[model samples]
Structure formats: structure tokens, C-alpha cells
Target: MFDFVPTRSDGDALREYAELFRASFPDAGHLNETYLKWLYSENPSGKVVGFDAYAEGRLAAHYVTVPADVFIQGVRQRGLLSLNTATHPDFQGKGLFTELARRTYERGAELGFNFVYGVANANSTPGFIRKLGFQLVRPLDAKISLGHVAKVDWPAVCRTAAFRRQWTEAHLAWRARNPQNAIRFASNRDGVLTAFASTDKPGVVVAGEFSPDGPVTALPCASVPILPRLFIGLLPEASRRRGLAIDVPKALRPSPLNLIYLSLDQKQKTLPADQIALSFLDFDAY
Candidate 1:
């Protein structure tokens, strides 16, 4: 009852993708033409591979896979992330989600992507794990490590799994640089930026994502949130800080989210969940 059209990697197709995103996820603040161009069109690694399903010439469902070169245990692997998936309200519960996903993955395989990964919400996690053979990696957790600040070498850490997002200098430059906020950045001796923290809250420095090798300086004031436990393990034991309760409204919490992946080749199967490191930066922020 619908026609699936593979979208080309061009400006026009990217606009169409953004339009569908706005139509489907109306409440999402980040669904804009600029962000879509930044994500799918201007990505340094490659363009996004996706399809738009139309019912009688009306766009019904949208799906896309953003490819990233994942490094694990000193080896780089071709990986695709299932992203920007949505179905119009008019076409919900018609099996479009599964069909579009299947077709997208099949095309991704032909394009040399050996695996696909997604940080799926509870509602969609089961479909990927039970039906699509995606393994449950782990829940994204917050941790506080007691540690002295160490110099972070950005280039050196790029070969590690902890550097999940392929954020080039251009991408970082385009982000809002509102100096009015309490957000502060830490840089190494070479002047390369390593970590950032939001000092907005009265007594806590809300640490944002950073390079895995970066030092997480514990403030005398106490507490940081949204940091992954895996990165906390990298700190030297002597300087580690105690984990503090990171309280937030239930609606703002993504506790129900889980990381899932499906390996399409033997080489990809070797990359286990324990080695994969991720932060809020790795996933699409909406």
C-alpha cells in the first residue's frame, strides 16, 4: 500500500528528511534544516543512508542509518547507527517500522557496513533485540570517580572506543558558544580542548561528555551528572571521587534507554559491548 523511495545523499533529500522529522516528531526542538544538514549532509565520514516511504505520494515513514568508523581494541570497524526513525500518525501500527528497518539494513550491508547499533528506548528496544538479533549491551549509567586531573591527549585517544562520536572541529565550532552560561572548558597543555563542565547549578558542576583519556576533576563543591561509568573506570584509583546521587525529573531521564547492536559479519561479532564506550554526545539529542 506504500512506495519506499531510497533518498539520495544531496541537499534536497536532506531537506525532505528534515521535513519528515518535523512532521513526525513535532515536539522535538532540534529538528531543523540546519541540524539536519549538519548531521546527514556535512558529516565528514559520509552521508546518511536512508529511505522515505510514501503512501499514495504522501510521506508516511522515514528511516536512516548514519555510518561511523568505530574503533575497538585498536582496530577500526565500519559501523552504522540506526537513527532518525519515525512514522506519521496516520500510518502507525501498519508494520512500516519493521519493513523500513529491514530494507535499510539490507542496503547498509551491501554498502559495506558490517554492523548497526542504536540506543533504543524501552518501547523500541524489544523489537531490535528479540526480532532483529541486536544484543543488549548495557544501560547508560552515571558514575563519579575520585581522581586527580591528568592531561588528556586528544589525538592519542581517537584510536580508542571511548571516542564514540566523529565530531570534527567544524561541528564543535557550530555549537552555541553562549558565554553567559556557566559552561567552562578544560584544555590540555598543548591547548587542545579535552573536557567541559556546566557550573550552572549552585553546588554542582554538571560534567558534559569528554574524551575518555580526559581528566575528570572533582570539584570541592560536589557532584556531576550524565557521565558514563565506563569512563569513570579510567581514572586512577587514588584520586577517584565517590558517586553522588544525580537527581532529575522522571520525564527528563533516559533511564529506560539501552544500547543495542546487530553484527552482520564475523569481524563485527568480535567487538563486544564491554569495549564500546558511549556518552550522551554519541546519540542524537532531541
Candidate 2:
């Protein structure tokens, strides 16, 4: 029988975790050890949690949870964001992932989290939906705008006392929390600052307020008809080479967004018939 434990700040334990991740997803490319170290480090004010499963004396599976505050129906709610779940290929079908995930969910609930989120790919979504009984929320709305200048005028925007204070705090917080992720900031000639946060796969431009006092609003550019096409156009050649497919929200399709299909829980009261489909991104595992 294997034992599951929360990974404390042990260097050896973390190295084992990284090795397991690489072995589990050999095609995902390099994930630097330094990056994983920073990710597992704890902050009193931050919202990241790490766990590991051990079989005999070796690490078998690992996962991380990121605490996010999401707005649902104009109310700010706490969300548990699951990421980087992996198990050694040698341990496949041994139920390590399922065991680890259930324990993680219980721990998250104990920590006062209301929802669990994850983005699953084609191989794992069905099991998450069928076996775990996780309800599918609405497909995340993602839009992209191209011809975007890669540069920004940070100095000019920093001139404003309010903008400078908020920008500095947000930037630092983001960096400290997401050491493995890339965050870019820029400003235009009009002194309007824009911030973007992305992983190697998908990118999101931070536009509106995401705080308790702030109201959630989609980006103005998100409404542009060409945004979807622009996003599809921007996929990295490497991702396309590997057969990465973009999953678009159903409501956004056919109008300007050109989304393909959407995933929703059939048991959910609000789901529309014929509009629901299997999600490429699993909400429970994100």
C-alpha cells in the first residue's frame, strides 16, 4: 500500500516529484528543476498547495492546487485551481491519481474552497466526468487579438501614483506566485497599461478587476469578430505539430468567436440541450 503526504520543504522530495513529472509526460518538454522548486515554495499570503503520493519508498504521483478567486454571477467565490497532475508511467491504472485527487479535494474543502477547477486534455476528461461525478461548468471564454504590439510603455504608466502602486503590487504578487509562468506588461502611447499572463500553451490578457471590490468585466477587444481567427492563427507551430486543438466556448461559436464545441454537465440545471459536449478541459482537474 502507498502512502500520501503533503510535500513539505524537502529538496530531495521535490527533486523526486520533478523526475516523476518528466517521466510521466516525456513529450511535454523540459520543466526546469529551479522552476518546480519555486512553485512548491510556500508564502503566508499566497494560495498554492502541493502534494505527493509515495509507493514503497519512491514517489509515484504529484499535484498542485492554486487558489483563485473567481466571479460567478457577480459574486466573488473561492476556486481551487488544480495543475500539473502526473503519475509515473510504471504506476498507470494503479489508482494513484484518483486517490491523490480525492484527498486533495477534501483538503481544499477544509481550507474553505468552494469550487475545484482543472483543464484536462482528451485522454483524461472522460474518466473525470464519468468516474468522479464532477459537474462541468461553462467552457472558459478565451479570445485573442493579433497585430498586437509586443512592446509597452511602462514608464509612462508608472507616472500615475495610483497606477504605479497597483501595477507594482499586482506584478510582484503575480511573479512570486507564478515562478514557472510568464507575465508580460506594456503600455501604449495613450499611457494605457496592459498586462498578459500565459503558459506555453494558452495566454490570457488581464483586463478587468478581479478583486473583492472590483467588478468583473470582459476585455473590450474580446468582442472583436476577428479575435478567434487571430487566436487560431497564433498557435505555436510546435503545438500544432503535436496536434494541440483549441476548445472554444459554444455560445461564442458561429457569431464572431468561431468556437467548435462546448462541454457542460448534463446534470446541471442550466445546461442547454444539443449545446453540451465533452470538454477538452476538465473543470475538476484544473
Best by lDDT: 1
Positional deviation of 277 in candidate 1, in angstroms?
1.9
Backbone clash pairs in model 1 (N, Cα, C under 3 Å; residues 3+ apart or in different chains), count: 6
**What value does the lDDT take at residue 74 in candidate 2?**
29
Per-residue CA lDDT of model 1 for 29-130, tens digit only, reads 466666666667666567887787899988888888887766545566677878888888889989887888888888888888877878887888889877
Which sections of candidate 2 miss by over 4 Å? 42-47, 140-144, 147-168, 171-181, 187-193, 197-286
After the best TM-score superposition of candidate 2, give how far the Cα of residue 119 lies from its true spot, in angstroms. Answer: 1.8
Q: What are the RMSDs of all candidates, in order?
A: 6.7, 11.3
TM-score of each: 0.71, 0.58
lDDT of 2 at 132: 59
C-alpha RMSD in Å of predicted model 2 compared with the true structure: 11.3
